[model samples]
Target: MEPPVNTIKLSQTAKDQLLKLRRHTKIDQWNILCRWGFCRSLAEASIPSPVPIPADSNVELTWKVFGGEMSDILILALKQRCHNDKLGTDKETLAHQFRLHLHRGIGYLAGDPNIKKIEDLIAIATKK
Candidate 1:
């Protein structure tokens, strides 16, 4: 399958929220945090809320930067998720969902009440 596009951009509000998550998580790299966000959203039992975030920020990441060593795996996961959601698996649809899931995951990480520190992320991960 074709890898996801590198045109993924975040909204200003998303950048701000991510910055907040950075401060809380103490993880400096945006791409790393973004990977966490992507997985978090994908792991959710339901579809993300339909709120369309504006692509206003200058921050940009290639597929390599976003997924690092797991780029291909991430693409596969996204494709599988698209199929599960009954969405088209075309490049365009994948690109759109890449944006949606990333933002929704960012929102999830930043919005969670229990994640006050880096250790909190581990707590959530191990939670039953």
Candidate 2:
């Protein structure tokens, strides 16, 4: 069935979580990719293996452990995988991974104790 038109509506709690996620994503992107040390480590670690790699492995684990940008490393891995015609996987894997990251990030933000009363404040902050 088609989705509802009013689906754009979100509870204040959800809105706050999203705002936090966006900020977190942006920070991670900059601090990890823009930093010389982190960027070099990530690029060095992103090289494909001599043998075939699995489709769903934590592509950024090595780089992440080395202070590389986790998000950037993951994106590069996914893009490489997506471009390989020999791989049997489809775009569904990419979509699912994106959704999983979003869910985890939002949950993390919601569970932060420092964000008390964030549920109500989120909507106000997110309205643009």
User: Whose TM-score is greatest here?
Assistant: 1
Model 2 spans with C-alpha error above 4 angstroms: 1-13, 19-72, 77-89, 114-128
* Number of the predicted model whose lDDT against the real structure is largest: 1
Tens digits of per-residue lDDT for model 1 on 19-126? 998989899999988998899899997877667789899888877788888988999999999999999899988888888899989989999987778898888777
Least well predicted 10-residue stretch by lDDT in candidate 2: 1-10
lDDT minimum window of 10 residues, candidate 1: 1-10
Give the whole-model CA lDDT for all candidates, comma-separated: 0.87, 0.36
Q: How accurate is candidate 2 locally (lDDT)?
A: 0.36
Cα lDDT of model 2 by residue, 2-30, tens digit? 11111122234434544564464443432
Q: TM-scores of all models?
A: 0.92, 0.29
Clashing pairs in 2: none
The superposed Cα distance between candidate 1 and the true structure at residue 45, in angstroms, equals 1.5
Question: What value does the lDDT take at residue 23 in candidate 1?
Answer: 89
